[model samples]
Target: MDVVKYLQRAGYTTVQKSFYAKIAEWESWYIGNVRKFHRYRIYNGKSYVSCRRLGMGMAKKLSEDIADLLLNEKVQITIQDSSTHEFVTQVLNDNNFWVMGNDYQERKAYTGTVAYIPYLDAVRVSENGEIVDGGTVRINYVSAEDIYPLSWSNGYISECAFVFYKTVETKLYAQIQIHKLQNDQYVIENHVVECTNGAGREVPSEKWKDLKDFSGLSEWVETGASERQFVVDRLNIVNNYSKDNPMGIAIFANSIDILQGLDTIYDSYINEFVLGKKRIFVAPELLYTDPLGNPAFDPNDVTFYQLPEDTLKDGGKPITEIDMNLRADAHEKGINDNLNFLSVKCGFGQNHYRFDNGSVQTATQIISENSDMFRALKKHEIVLQSVLEELIRIIARLGQKMNIPTDPDSKMVIDFDDSIIEDKQAERSTDRTDMSMGILRHEEYRAKWYGETLEEARKNLPEQNQVIE
Candidate 1:
């Protein structure tokens, strides 16, 4: 769908549409539909060619790996207020935030940008436009192609439009939700239009009944909150494609050539077995037809071929075997080399991945803090941390608007998983040694190891003079 056309038709400003074309290209690569070249072959002095669309599916693999490293079930997000934390957790669980959040990270890794928009669902507004009762906050995940930056500053998108496509009875429609700032308050505008022939035209709201009843939605909403209700998350890479572009570029955007090379090598490796199969040339006189006109030999056996009459005129043998040498080792080495290059170019460092047994395997050894992979993970966490914190705050605000007991200003603590980069058992051993030597306090060690506050650890400590070893 031409989302930009719909955004423009809805009177919303948008970034250059050309950038989304690049997003589509990246999406194609992620899905392994890239067509780099074609293959031609000569059989029986006749030349034939066909398009070759092969890939290693490395784009998606890299993105998924990044997502797993960045945000997993082990990662903890806690709010200072216990009740607030429980409420928020329930809300996130109801929406499957952890799973969908990882998916958002993966999409952001490949498409360069993803958004989280929180809205109040099933709410009632009083005559004074105040939310009276019965509303729940819900999140809408948006990828780059559907995200339209209306206004941004210094890479922060303050005003934006998100396009959502819906199909009803084979007819397509676009709903453009625009978040803009007016009178220091964030105002949301909704537009539903018909998407036809690459253009968008106005449509009546009654055409889509769910638009109003689904979320207590309206054509215009004036949220009393000052902050934008949406959060845009992207990789930490500087966008070199367009200096003025706020959208992020894919993590492997600069390594597309390496990806293509890897796919080419892998494709060649797979074809080696097909082209190097054993073949037998048989003289036509030796292979007679049956009474029913069927060949004496199994016709399904493609390895056997009839030799030309001229070939047998020089006293050639009745049957000759031809076996082409397979370059399996050479092809494997080429593919491994390309995979190493791809790993490094995508910031995973050298030897992070290996191609083995027709599959890609990631190294499982713990990475040191000084390694490139460690640094890259930390760098990405910077942006992700902010994105998640902002999303939480927005959720809290929406919860407050719904009269749910929540503290929008509560302190949020996000503990990302670092077990892959740090040796937890060794660290714990060292801490134990330090505590025995009086270098580290017992409460401090307990708090650090057990994921607790200092006061809580101190309160739960054993008697000072009692050694219960």
Candidate 2:
């Protein structure tokens, strides 16, 4: 989709479309639809070439694994206010944020950036035309290719536009939502243009008549709040693609060559089995013939082939079995070596992935706190933590607008899943020992292990007499 052109037509200026086009390239690799290569082979003394797709699919796996590591069901987001926390939890559950949120993370990992936009749904109005309720907050997850920065400074995107598509029957339309700062307040503009080609290309000015004035939505909305209603999340990496670019590059963007190498090695390993199967060559006289004189062998036996009649006369064996050597060991080693290189390049420590016995296995060993994977996870969580906090704040603000008695200023705490990197059991044992040695306080231990605030842990501590029991 030519999102930039269409957005411009909607009166919203944005970054060049080529930036998003680059994101599309990363998306292709993430889905394993990389550039096709020609495979040449010789059959019947004639050379043939065929286009083949790389079947490793490691790029998708890398994104999925990193996303899972960053955000999973085990991760928790806490809001201090009971009412606001309950409301946000209910909203997240309603939206299946646990599942879809991880998917969004995967998209963010591969596409470099993603946005979470909170919009009200099923709004209610009073007799005086005042909003009685701001309605439920629904989230729209936009990936990199659809995100256009309208205004940004110092690597921060202050105003942006998100492009979405809706298809009515067979006709497609582009829904451009622009979030811009007007008079220090965020204003949202919505425009819908008919995509005559169904590809979101720029529609000619003469064809503006086909544009929808409004997509069953308000033409523009003054959010009444200074803060944005959307949260942008991205991997913690420098945008080497463009130093001034506000967007981030994919986690594996710097390691595309390694990814291609991994796929190439894996493809070769797979093909080895197909091309190295044993074969039996039988002399022509030893082969049976059907009624029509067609050479015949056991129908179920595909490994045998009839050889030329002059084979035996030329001092060749009448029947012979050719067992070609399969370099399974060598191929496995090559794949594993490349996987290690890829793992290190993508921020997972070396040996994080292993290809053994035709199966891929993730390293299950506990990672030290100082390990690269741990540091990378923490770096990523820095951005995600703020994103989740902002999303909660948006939900709270929307609830307040609806007169839902929400505290938008409530403090939020995000606890990311670290079980994959930390050895929880061992850490708990160490903490226990520290507590016994007077190096750690009991309340601190409880606060850490019970996922409670220090005040809560101190208040909930048992009395001295009760501890005797």
Candidate 3:
């Protein structure tokens, strides 16, 4: 296949690269390599103050908060069919799906992820006692940069291209899964994909065609969507981050640049403050000045200045110490302003983070109905609920493919513990009051308390009614 032409037809190379760049920046910030991403400027003949400053870690912290708030505790998932429920439960346990969800959540927070079913071999014995092929179900997670949405309508992706690399024969080979419509039906066509090397040649290994698995019948099932076995998780999308793009921005994308700027300014202030505080001018006669005529002293040594009797004639000491305290106040104020701006822009709300006494501190957690942070968490919770629901459907589809009779329409209940956002006991007290007053049904009250959906709570409602009657 013409890899270049195919990529051109898909027209996501630019978008993919752009997303890759953002991922790179987010990754750098996550791991504390932020200085290079937002380098500090040097001016006024001042050498670049190469001070190692602590990174903001805003992306890392925010992503971690998302995972912890959404999936740190047990995620309540309910399926109707007993057999399918057990099967999916085992699959999730074996795959550590909840733990994997944390990693996936981090990915979604950064650049989004694609969940797809990959074909695998399931072992079966033939009647003649020979081992034979049985289709296996496996869910594979791919990153946004690797999975490109080729076509879309009404904000839904119709076609996609998943490009990845495999090492075969000690050489890197490009592999692509093009999930597109064939004969007016969705089909996944595997290709030995290649891209232009430095020489601009469509270079593919001789083993590329041999590696293609063309034997099995295509796994085809209508998902009521254009794609057969893939779902895109777009979290916190931003516009104009790049040219007309399909990829969603990271959760903290809006504030990363600001955070970067803040990091630089904070570091610069620190370096300047440290230098000023340590600045000791020893009667220019005791120290040497550099070409810039700035007093230079050996930082590694303690210098002693000898004072002549004449120097103290007017009670003026030979040593002059400059107190930069007032100047540092301005820097401190600027740093505080930026930190508050970052906190608010990143959805943590104003004063969530505070700069105090040369260190940063987070404001105490407030569990109040009127709290902005609680509202922010609720907004994100809504999006997270939808994402988890979609993921459960994908897993259920995999279960069906594995011959575990799963009802695709089976309801899934995702109970996120809102205790972190508000006072759970107080809320429960209010719920109990409402229940006693007949303002809320017993099933609804129980569902809220037990973290169950109304339908799941109804299974036990009959017994309670019988006892009460």
Candidate 4:
């Protein structure tokens, strides 16, 4: 067995440094200063080392035997290719170091760089670093809730995300389940959380604010769509100014059949802030309508299909077009009407029309349809902000028209041209409204009186005077 050539085959550049380390009795500098592998301590020691002997046959069994002896002998050896480190480590795992096999793994090696020759020996790194391998749990899915320390924003339902990114193909279905505590009986609740705030953020006005087992747990398969995608904590939506709230979230798997069944689902507590409540698990799609419609895309007319096409489809009915359109149109109309109302209330540079009561009657008229009006600017802040810009524009126009003083910090409101209104009564869409002020201000505008005013207004008429007699 040529140690020098073996090192060369292992791709070790410094042949003497690698080979001499093997035969040295004690940890000697020539052999003691072996090399570095990320997790394992590297040193060279002589073995009945295999060079190019078993010719073309890489016996995994021989590597296993060598690994056992190294562990018993407590000698360190370096293999050239790190690619086979897993195989060698498996032998070590089988012989000794029977703690958890997959975690805090000392198997970190560059794919093409160093490899484990036979097996190397080293003591467990630390009391804290010592892992009770707990043998191995062929975990179909691991819920991080029990182990990982989780923190999430309060007030909103949070989702617990579970990311399973493995090479082997597996199909596993996972859903979060919550049991509400009531009358000492735990009732299972499903589809409790809502994806409010348009996107999947804060909770809606649906759930109690202080429910226990608050959802902030997110669960899902590791699709690699959005990075930082891992299933570490529970999820829920909270207000913009919420503090951290803790709760329990449970994970359930469909079946344990697949070779790589990493249960993947994004989940949340419907309402965590509610006190004395059972945990509620929910599937997002269960309570959802596809943003546009169809759950999965159809090759035919897949306009509103689900993205990626891999997600299992769930369907519930949506409202009729009439209902949906009615609501949406109502919202749109509400915005426009509110603006109109604001314009009239602010006088729009017109002499404010007042009833005998001295209160503007038009203001009342503006709000008459408030019930049906969409609150485009309903929230105090939202409305004020929207009107601020339009208000400035209106003030500028009014100053030009009536020489009116514009309030600097006002929500600008101005009158609409008459012709722009509906014609139910007299069709006011013309430049002159049903009011007389706009007409009076026009230079070429003529006034037509109804009865006596016509004669009076025309009294200066030179030609028509004889007809009046």
Residue 431 in candidate 4, Cα distance off native in Å: 13
Q: Using lDDT as the measure, name the better of candidate 1 and candidate 3.
A: 1
- Top TM-score: which candidate number? 1
Weakest 10 consecutive residues of candidate 4 by summed lDDT: 259-268
Candidate 4 overall Cα lDDT vs. reference? 0.24
lDDT of 2 by residue, 243-326 (tens): 588898898898888887887787788788888989998988778777898756784788998788799899999889989899
Could you estimate the TM-score for every candidate?
Answer: 0.89, 0.88, 0.76, 0.12
- Measured by C-alpha RMSD in angstroms, how accurate is candidate 3? 7.0
In lDDT terms, how accurate is model 2? 0.81
Best by lDDT: 1
> Residue 158's C-alpha lDDT in candidate 4?
23
Which residue ranges in model 1 land beyond 4 Å of their true spot? 6-12, 35-48, 126-130, 197-199, 206-216, 289-299, 309-311, 435-447, 453-469
User: Candidates ranked by TM-score, best first?
Assistant: 1, 2, 3, 4
Poorest lDDT segment (10 consecutive residues) of candidate 2: 35-44
Show model 4 residue runs off by greater than 4 Å: 1-151, 154-174, 177-220, 227-469
Q: Clashes in candidate 2: how many?
A: 1
Question: Where is model 2 more than 4 Å wrong at Cα?
Answer: 9-13, 38-48, 124-132, 198-215, 289-297, 309-316, 432-443, 462-469
Per-model lDDT: 0.83, 0.81, 0.62, 0.24
- Give the poorly placed runs of model 3, Cα more than 4 Å off: 1-6, 9-37, 40-55, 112-136, 166-170, 183-185, 193-227, 242-244, 277-329, 367-371, 462-469
Please state every model's RMSD to the true fold in angstroms: 3.8, 4.3, 7.0, 38.9
Superior by lDDT: candidate 2 or candidate 4: 2
Clash totals, every prediction: 0, 1, 0, 76
